[model samples]
Target: MLVEINLLPKKEPRNLSLLFAIVTFSGMILIGAAFLIWQMNEKKEELANVENQVQLTNEILEAKRTKLADFQSASSVQELEKAIKWAEKQPYNLVYVLQKLTKILPERGFLTEFNLEKDSIINLIIQFDTKSEAAYYLNSLLNYKWIDEAVITKEKAGDWEIINNKTPLSDDQLTDLAKKNFFPRYYAEYEIRLNIAELKQAYKSEMEKSKEGNKGEEEGGDSP
Candidate 1:
């Protein structure tokens, strides 16, 4: 066999495993850094979108608040105009009418219901101690300066003892009670016509003064 011995020391196999591992680790780090940057940019875009939505909602609320204020002002003016028109249509001052009616009430009677109808007719329901008291009140109303005609349209009488009895009374007891002259409570309804012509003539000067005052106020309001 031929001799194959070399004088130089045999060269060991090149150790390239460490350099390959370093290159692979560096590539993985670069890929991870790029992904993290992309995620951060996405988060920034989401925050910007939320802020824009909040600003738009605030603008819409502010517009509605302005409209509500204007509506309230218009409603107040409309209500005042309606009240003025109603006052103009009234035939007489309610307070004055009530005062006059109260002054003419009979001493033995009190008004239960009072209704004023068209053409100055008044329907009155009154309670009295006796029927005679009711008749007297009707005569007084006829003679009153403000009333033109007065008539009793309905009359009713009730005894408190009979009405409030819990147990039914025997025939003997009822007969005994009937023997005594007992006057029961009387309720009378009257219809009276007011003297509208006389009333209007008396209040004409005051009415004219009130109308002139109202006209002046309206003119002042229309100026500015």
Candidate 2:
């Protein structure tokens, strides 16, 4: 019977080998895709970790810099204070000492040469109308607490005085640099030198010793 005949050949038993090949290929593709996804996720995690580390390092560096700046500011202030204290401890004030010296000068008397020595000796010159005024000025200088000794080194009279190498003062009757003695008009100039060192205890002791020696000498002289 020519039934609708099993056409082709029994539908070719379903080609199992080809189906197995397709399934294997599909499974391999799936496994490859999953591995790629896992690698991408791991790389993202590593990048995140690196970013966090960089941020933390920057924060620490900034903190250290701020601390260093503060330390430097404080150190500068402390150093300035130390420098001021050192300046305050210094013993000499030239301007103040000069002012003190100027205040003691007489109205008519003026200084010609005044110089300070390295060893605290003062070489000074003062000109006045009369020797009496000059002597008075010298005694007054010695009375100052700062002066240890005052001595007049020389005295001279001149009608014309060479106050310095460059400047000369003409003491005629008009300028009164010179006053008339019996002979001529002349000015008296005094050259004085002095030492200034105030050691209170030592000076007191010296005075005591001098008084004792004088008393002993007087007693011996009286007995003889």
TM-score, prediction 1? 0.41
Error at 131, model 1, angstroms: 1.2
**Tens-digit lDDT track of model 2 for 1-224:** 57575557554588989999999999999999999999999999999999999999999999999999999999999999997785465354444455656677656566777665543566767666555566777787777666666777778754333332235533334235343343222233433333334533435566699999999999999994
User: Which pairs clash in model 2?
Assistant: 178-186, 178-187
Candidate 1, residue 175: lDDT: 35
State each model's CA lDDT, in order.
0.73, 0.64
Per-model tally of clashing residue pairs: 0, 2
Residue lDDT tens for model 1, 1-224 = 79987899889986699888898999999999999999999989998998888898888888898888888888889999987786567776555556666666655457789886775888989876555667777877776566788888998865733443544765335434534654335688988887776666646766788999999999999997
Listed in order, each prediction's TM-score against the native is 0.41, 0.38
Candidate 2 stretches with Cα past 4 Å from truth are: 1-8, 93-224
Misplaced by over 4 Å in model 1 are: 1-88, 160-184, 202-224
Pairs that collide, model 1: none
lDDT accuracy of residue 139 in candidate 2: 81
